[model samples]
Target chain A: MFFFALIVKPLVLFILGLNKRGQNNLPVKGPAIIAANHNSHLDTLVLMSLFPIAKIHKIRPVAAADYFLRSGFMKWFSTYCIDIIPLDRKNRVNKKALFAECHKALDNGDILILFPEGSRGTPEQMSQLKKGVFHLVKDRDDTQVTPVVLRGLGRALPKGTALFVPFNCDVVIGQPVPAQEKADDFIKLLASRYDNLFQYCVTHQEPEQ
Target chain B: MFNIPQNSLYTMLLVLLFLCIGTITRLVLKAKFPQKDYTELRQRIQSWWWMVAILFFALVFSKTTAIILFALISYLALKEFLSIVPSRPADRRVIFWAYIIIPFQYYWAATSWYGMFIIFIPVYVFLFLPMRMVLVGETKGFIRSAGVLHWAIMLTVFCLSHIAYLLVLEDKNPQAGPIGLVLFLVIMTQLNDVSQYIWGKLFGKHKIIPKVSPNKTWEGFLGGLVTITILSGLVAPILTPLGFAYGLLAGLIISSSGFIGDVVISSVKRDLQIKDSGSLIPGHGGILDRMDSMMFTAPLFFHFLYYVKY
Candidate 1:
């Protein structure tokens, strides 16, 4: 495993030039919510490589249980390699535990990578964000919700697509939003932010800060 | 599979010894002084150690392989540079010329075509690129667009190829071939950067230019020179055919120039209102971050070798 990480990974990067952008927004310390719109499975790896191994160890990615946790190898790889948190989307009863786990991860000062879109959608349109993000922020006032927009992943490895189209991926990390408002108001605020984010992306733009 | 023979082990050991001197100096400086905020100088040092380690391998490889690797490095570094800087759609035609010139320049180096590689980009590509764009009959963004393309090609493609040019030596002394010259140039230039940064961090009492580069200090400048001189003295035999005093002089030239190079790029980023050139590398901020040292180091190092060794 160490050999794969230190040797194989860098070799691949050296060959491909592993072009990435907006990686500096990754916090060097403490807990934050990496809220991104989902596009493909490779999106997780793309985001993970944007930081060092030590920081990556502290990040817990929230993946849907019904899809990824079905197989034992998938479960082990996801859990061990990326610290994926399998949320059973089919069962509402399981959501309570999942939410608690996210909070627990945050409380431990670990980063929780969340897909607010809930599922993959058409590349032309982003998935309407589930209210889980709003609730998560509202519950933990201290936790920062960082908006991470990943482009070109759908092209790399699209959902329902078997072939991996080799392409450059860009990961943009926006400034963190402090949890200050109520759930409904926070949801509206976040939704509007998502709307602007998608607009910026579609326009192929950056915030001129 | 061009491998360096075991007889070259003594030379490799000398390179390692020089690396140790620089690394130890850095450690002492880091311990003596630490930054409260996340500054560019702090970040450069953090990644430079790893850069030195990679360079160790580059120096150890067989002469032919080392030349190819440096060419690839120049290519990758240039690719990262072009991606971030915005070029108008009109510049597309000229960019095609720019990409092809990358490999051609390296081919000149590989075949020991010294005269052509030196003049190819500045003389031929420089004239040809603008002429091609002018023929396209696009008046829109004529100056601003052409200027960006020119800057990218000059800095990324032209200046960087100087590292490859180091592979071709006028004197074919097998004792210290072109590979040794290349190694010497890289080590001396990089050592200057690492040492100056360490000195500045440890005893950087007064900011030289607060607005342009806040972390730079007079104390650091003097300290870095002493450190680099000592390093040049140690690593002279393995990487270069230079005597200790000559190596010290060469190291000083590379370090001072590299410092100026870093400041120039920093000013560009500030003007652009961006923290980094572009976040292409983790821990390391941008293409510019990795290339900041190289921009000045390459041209300066090449000429120093050209004058001394050639």
Candidate 2:
């Protein structure tokens, strides 16, 4: 928390600026899900920094265990520093156990940040979302799943790139999609919500020659 | 307490006076016309207070601080401009180079390297960026991308950096230092903007450029010109080394160029099909929206002063 407030927040705010809209749509109290498109590693940090520092303890990002836990230092950093709930992406045998931790976090009223696109894709392009977010929210009708679309972070600090060019990124938080009975229906609803929210980003103008 | 310059101190006081006057006028107007919403006016005034305070401290602190402040302004304006304009995916690396140019550009101003500072963007950056873009092997939309990227750098970084370069001027005027020169230019430019808006609202019948900016009128333009010219004639001698005649010329240059800058950005916004560039400032729109006139006025004012005094 000290590290985040001192370093991460300022770096995110000052260097890579976030022009956020619908910040009020983020539930004040949680038992909530913040599902956004994955573009860059900065997406997690940008979203976490959006909340007040006091609520930083209650917010947890669900990340891939295979990637985040590959190195000993990374495991420690992801677990302690970022406070991620590491999900086992390799083995489906422990799927129930993996979801148990997520259920437990929500049961404790912690906000879980999930990237439904599975992993970082092409910069500023949205890939087909996996059904993982749907499975998490399917039974938990009480939990509010907020769809957030992050633009320009991918361009600023996209995957396979260490260099961070300064760019104004947009964080558009939409009204929480109500839990549907079917997984396909839920994913469709979430996808449509993201489509609607993506429109609110900085309107792309044809470069005048 | 900080060994502030006498001229800078007076300018700060004058700015505070204007802020007070604006507040009192708004209060009186709210009282008289209770039905009308003064929310936008109130927001504008509040934002002005913040902008003025930040700018005042930056200019008065030190030359380095002032240069860095303007550099940040250039970064923000460029960010807003880039976010609005569409860029090719291949040009993303080229965009990184664009951001990198800002620091080097300001470094020239900080060191007062006039020879390199003048040609860095137009000559070096203009040639280098396209070559770098060509290396990406994506020729589709190549010309358009190069044009957009270069223009963004020129407008945001190259033009606005002139304000910072003002601080490093080798002038012999004891009464008007480099800081005073900056204060003079900024105050005159902003005052020109305010007076034009007020005049336009009061009696803006003849549309000057209705297609680009519907709100701009000839009456407003002339009213603002006369007001700024007279004010400059009075104020420039105190803040700058210019006499009354040169001051009037400075006023004429700022007012007309400031209008061109405003409409130029307006035309860009119109072409982009957006109302505001970004919602960085409450009433002013974006940093680009606020500094659009400065983009034009800064370079022109610097050259004018350079030719005359420097």
Candidate 3:
């Protein structure tokens, strides 16, 4: 975490030119979920850098176990450097056990960063969101779910490519959505909130002078 | 201690005085008018202080530092341009190569390699980038991508580099040196912008180009032209080898070309259908918004001085 704050945060902000908006929406204390769109590997790094370095230990990005923990080195880096909460993607029988760690993190007042897209998608294009976020927040009406929209990172370091290009990225955080009672209602509310925040990333046609 | 040129020192002091005045005026405005929101004005003044400090150190430190600073500015300007402009996914590698050209271009300017600095972008990279894009094999939007990328390089890198080149020019004026020339051009160009805004607010009636830039007017244009021409004439003898008459001509070139540059960028924003390029600066918008005039003034003023004196 010390190494990340000292090195990775500055390096990511400098290279990516992270232009953030509505940062005040980020919950100062957690038991909260920061749900953002997934586009690139740099997404996790960029999101982590947004929080204060002192709370680095309290922020945990919920990543896929198989993908992030594929190799020995990646597992070490993902667990230690990024401090991610690895959730098993293939565990179908024990869904309840899969979310035990997430529930524990929330109970302990830690912020969990979740990309509801489940996996990386095409550059600059939003994909179908997974229902895992709804599962995590359902029945926990007190836990705040903040919707964040990330644009231009896919172009910078999109999936299936190792070459990094410097592109200016926008991070738009929206007001937290109240947890809905039904799973479908919660998912729909989250998606709608995302759509609203995503509008901030779109370049509107300004009236000509 | 670095031997600061006499004219450069005097110019720095003048800039400091202006900044102090701006601070006082901002404070007075806030205190006197409690209801009025002075956020934009305050942010503009704050950005000005930062810009002046950065430019001051870059000029005072050494020639290498100044060149590096301009190179970084070119990088930022180009980044902001590329970010706003429509680009194809296939041209991603092409964009990477475009950024790679910045350092090499600045290197030529820093080493005083006039041969490469002049033609490297226009001749070599102009031809080279299209070929690299062709190799990517995405024929769709090929021409548009090539045109956009090439133009971005020209405006951001090729044009802005002239200011850095000014610092490396042979010291024809022993009293002022190259730093003075830089200060003179930058100050005159920015002064023309501020003077035009003030004059336009006071007496501007006739719209110059309503379609592109509605705010610009004939009154403001003429006011800025006269103000900059006289100011340039006054400062040229102190800063450059040009006499008062030649200085007026230099002023004429900078003021007119600066106006054209401002409108040209305005046209670009209109075409793109965006208000401010990016929110990099607090009140200024982006590096491109601030540098639109410099894009024209730097090259024109540099060449005019080179032709007349060097």
Question: DockQ, per-model, please?
Answer: 0.09, 0.46, 0.38
Residues B109-182 of candidate 3 have per-residue lDDT tens digits of 99999999999999999999999998999898889889999999999999999999999999987888889989
lDDT of 1 by residue, B1-310 (tens): 4354332445556656765675676667767776534355445555655665666566566545666676666666555555445444445456556767878888888788878988988888878888999997777777876777778677877777787776666534456566666666665666677788888988899877789888888888788878777777767655666678777877777777778878887887676655665455556776567677777878876787668766
Q: Is candidate 1 or candidate 3 better by TM-score?
A: 3
Candidate 3, A81-162: lDDT as tens digits: 8888999999967868999999999999999999999999777777888888888777686698899988888878888998
Worst 10 residues of 1 chain B by lDDT: B1-10
lDDT of 1 at A25: 62
Best-to-worst ranking by DockQ? 2, 3, 1
- Specify the highest-DockQ model's number: 2
The parts of candidate 2 lying over 4 Å away from their true place are A92-95, A203-209, B24-39
What is the per-residue lDDT of model 2 for residues B1-310, given as tens digits with 9 covering 90 to 100? Answer: 8566687677789789989999999999999999999999999999999999899889777889989999999999998898788887677789989998999999999999999999999999999999999888889898988998999999999999999998998855566677888999899899899999999999999999989999999999999999999999888888888899999999999999998999999999899887888777877777889998998999998899899987
True contacts kept of each: 0.04, 0.56, 0.33
Question: Best to worst by TM-score, what's the order?
Answer: 3, 2, 1
Chain B TM-score for the candidates in order: 0.80, 0.96, 0.99
Model 2 C-alpha lDDT per residue in residues A18-125, reported as the tens digit of each score:
777899999888899999999899999999999999999999999999999999999899989999998988767775786988999999999999999999977777
